[model samples]
Target chain A: MRLTTARRSTLFAGLAIASVAVLTACGTASGGGDSGEEATELGDYEGSVSILAWPGYVEDGSNDPSVDWVSAFEEETGCMVESKTYGTSDEAFSLMKTGDYDVVAASGDASLRLVAAGEVAPVNTDLLKNYDGIFDFLKMQSWNSVDGVSYGIPHGYGANLLMYNTDVFPDGLTSWSAVFDDAAANSGKVTAYDSPIYIADAAVYLMATQPELGIENPYALDETQLAAAVELLKAQRQHIGEYWSDYLKEIQAFETGDSVVGTTWQVIQNSITTGNTEVVLPDEGTTGWSDTWMISSQAKSPNCAYAWLDYIASPEANAQATAYFGEAPSSQAACEFRDDCEAYHAGDADYASQIWYWSTPIADCLDGRTDVECTDYAAWTTAWQEIKG
Target chain B: MSSAATPHVTAGVPQPRDTPARRISVFLSQHARVRLGLLLTAPLFWLGLVYVVALAALLITAFWTVDSFTGQVRTEFTLDNIITVVTGSLYQTVTLRTVGVALLVTVIDIAIALPVAFFMAKVAGPRLQRILVIAVLMPLWASYLVKAYAWRSVLAEGGVVDWMTAPFGGSSPGYGLPAVVITLSYLWLPYVILPIYAGLERVPDSLLEASSDLGAKTWRTMGSVVMPMLWPSIIAASIFSFSLSLGDYITVNIVGGANQLLGNLVYTNVGAANNLPLASAIALIPVAIMIVYLTAARRSGALENL
Candidate 1:
């Protein structure tokens, strides 16, 4: 019962990787294909176009009946759209890998993996009328591009910030150390992102604490550097009350006083923090990811896919998606459209100077890694289990 | 072998010396021509092909290695995955906890179910028994997620438990572990009650009368006579509860909160980590443990009468 937490975490990390392999096989075997061929022949995009998306990226008929974004796209293009919401980047990639949909709105965590695997094709930027309106920074994002070849259209973007209960940390909370290193004092009060991708948070912290490990960027950690970060995480897990992936669950955890501080995205922070809770951008920079809409390589209706992307990328459409999801829109024109867009806009020229945009931890790019090639996701996933344990 | 031993019957009459064609006709006559026979054969073949073969394939894939960059399974053999699982303390903890919880649920369910099933079978009239059975079965008809959500509301602040305890000067926050247990018990009560009730129904009135006539007290008659006869149904019900709790994800996910379970861990590995090998390895451990416990329980004379 009193075993060193480091040893226990290593053991769990190994188990976590083993579990992932089995689940992937089962998911791929069933429903294996892009939109079927016959669906393409339906005249002038009159038929249903299935798009794979992450939850909350697209509104359904359930959340607010009048807020269905797909209905407007349907009316504009004469194409009825059906979206199957995925809970994780892994699932979305797994689905797209099978070539089953006309489009997949992938997140930064997954879009690179998809492009490297050739599951999604390079979008013809010229064909997309709204492409010109997309911010230059977003068009050249690391995850959605390969050697300057753009693979996806920017859809939604948000930074991962620290959220804390003001009642618990009234002195204007600002550091991750107060959450991770001092977790023992905050036991049964802290929560972290529940996904494997959260291993990046540990990496981000280690670059400062264990500089000898040479972890330049959180995502670009190697095996040895990752092990050091994992050690830090094992110590932190004891303080955690919950590891939440669902936005609704995170909001509930904060509302119920089960969680005091942890990693959070803008959407959950916006929803959870009322008068009692507060969102903080720590002095040490945080991590963020941008979500994108990409045309599938196996698209049955390429023309319709282009049309769908064009309509959704418009200033009016991006404006609506940004307002609904509470994430920053990638289109510059979207911010000019409304006051709500101004609130989400993050630039040197704007007010959100504290927010750090997502950058892949490769050899080049702003805030990129200079150490051993970033920890391949394979190891991070394994380490994540141990961290949770 | 049974067919070879029997002489052919022609129109309810036995044929002492049968021709080859006549024997073939007789063999196919009654058992082979009916819709029921086709239905029975069809299901067996389907189960053998799909369930049995699919499970074997799943086990095979559990041993395969994964390609890191593409996230595809590589065509290579390795024991690293299995060893990783066996050595992992987190997996071991989750596995052990799942089994312990399942056993506790089984014991508690059986204790509660015995009396209810007894009353329905021995004390209640037919009409009353029917109504009671329906009342027990009603929850099963509802969607599982809906039921879990209902339980969450009842356990949360301003929930029914809080409302009931308000006058006692305690806040309406949940007693978390207690709420989870009560919810699981309520959800699986029908699974426990149904089998025991069915088993008790088979206990003949004559057997009870024979015991009573032997100068036995009501309690003694129940203990020595009626109880032994109901062992099979009780064992069957216990098995149902044990398995339901073993692989359950939704109940634990919705109710367990910060407390981790095997099902929740497995769900996370599969859904969040996207590590299929790990998920499969974790999934297999619970199933194997379940089989071992069930086998051991079966050997302890738990199902002798049934």
Candidate 2:
């Protein structure tokens, strides 16, 4: 027993030294809030610029020969574009800390975090000639601006619509109730987004249906309101066929008739050729994402990055990129360049204001109510797990 | 008897060696301790630096927490993450579900593997045995994701399984826990079969013939003689299928409908939640379970066999 105790002590000392080494080696960079480097001056473009974006964004005609935007940009500016696609905003936020990429198309869920962590800098609107053509509504918002300073230029936006099979809802339904209150009618055939951000969708419905609950902003839920939303989600869990984070899975499920009605992205609806599906923005209003092209604070080739951003936001490029990505263009002038821009409700400021865009939930109430302590993203994550169970 | 050779043997002068290797071999034969140490140094360094350090770092991070908004790790030590993981009902439920699925997969794979292995070992002609072995290994050549997608189509509502059972008034189980089990069993069956086949080969035919000569039947001989020797291989096979199924997140996602296992929980905490501390805590569950399984396996004399 005494010998074993001596050996155990030796092992513990070794483990202590090793752990200290690990902690010091992999220490995380501190959280963001600093004013980053000054805005870049437009001049001769650098040789290369790397970009991080969502899957369909920044396509260089590699995946499909017809999709060729980056190649043209490279030829036009002489700045070659190397792009990487991330699945979720959380992943994009984490990768931005590396400071390897020149610019990233970050969604609202990650944009604020990037700003707060000092990973991205405020944009100088004067550098771009086309800034005036962009919609005013997406220019200065809570996600893209801090204290009236614009940190990024808007890219594109899309809503999470209610897509239902005509075979299931023959009478043509029109509310979030088809997936929430009246979900049992299609039990085990409903699908929703598989992310903690999706909790806001439930809160949005409650804002309309259960007005007594006083849920003004879906992103800002105090304990009691969050509990109500969680309970509602738990009830809906029984009817969920699956929760999909990827558009391919959602498309496949819809095509196979495994999912009859639930939340869907515009891209998934477009990809479904067989199913007679219709998507409607419920009267309760839906959740959406407006991505911003924010340059990295430690961008090595700042000139190239700025040039790429301006080129992407230009009329013809914005039209092609947004239409290909299945979203509304950020600039109004891009509408004339594309035939179907009006159909996507591009730059429809009134319609855009009605949608609740995704934002990182925090302890402080984002709805401007200072009284109650709101639940944050971490809590939503844990609660989401519990709801799934 | 040349005078030069005689002088070298008598140590009047040293004889030249052709290469450093020859001199080193002669020196090593004289020093067994040095030879043993040199043989073990590389493997020990590799194991200590990679496996032990990574495991230790993971456990240490389990005690830390991340700031929710920043998604940055704070080095302050606390048991909160571990406590939450242990006390939470969701963790308990998912743990039970994962273990149940793992056990079911192991049973299914073993049931399918044993008879096939037996036939290959004792009954099949040489050519047939070679063909059977190739067939078992052929599925592994295809990508894991491709096979998972194939299963997804097979288990869909109007899929092959549904079409096959249509005349019997039955339907596919349709993407859920059952589908997960069936796919996992199919993926890991080759792993189960090869080890058991090797173990059965180790069983001498003379022993089986002797048992029969002593009036014992096939099942009795298999029960008394063959099973005792095959126990180690069976445990080895269980570890592969069990651990693979236990930590599988991708298969569950492709065809598991709305259900999640421990792997999904860890993945969610890591990627979507961005809570590395919680993810590390959740990851410890499968590690602990696997350690217990391996220890139990070692007690059954399987370690040497593996």
**TM-score of each predicted structure versus truth:** 0.82, 0.94
All candidates: TM-score of chain A: 0.82, 0.94
Top-DockQ structure, candidate number: 2
The residue-by-residue lDDT of candidate 1 on B1-306, one tens digit each, is 455545553344544677898776666675555645666788977875577656655666677666666666664567777887899887887677777778788888999999999999999999999999999999999998889878876776566777788899875444244555667788899999999999889999888999899999999988999888888788788888888888887776565655667777677666655566667777788778868876876797786656
Model 2 per-residue lDDT tens digits across residues B1-306: 577567556796565666999889999999998999999999988887687777777888898888777777887789999999899999999999999999999999999999999999999999999999999999999999999999999988799999999999999998889999999999999999999999998999999999999999989999999999898899889889999999999999999999999999999898888888899999999999999999888886778766
- Candidate 2 regions exceeding 4 Å error are A1-26, A29-35, A40-44, B1-42, B304-306
In candidate 2 chain A, what residue range of length 10 has the lowest lDDT sum?
Answer: A26-35
Q: Which candidate is the best by lDDT?
A: 2
lDDT of 2 by residue, A94-198 (tens): 788788898999998888878877889888878978778888888888888878888878889989999999988888777999999999999989999998888
Model 1, residue A349: displacement in angstroms? 6.5
Error of 1 at B83 (Å): 2.6
In TM-score terms, candidate 1 sits at 0.82
Error of 1 at B15 (Å): 27
Chain B TM-scores, listed for every candidate in order, come to 0.82, 0.89
Reference-based lDDT, residue B37, model 2 = 92
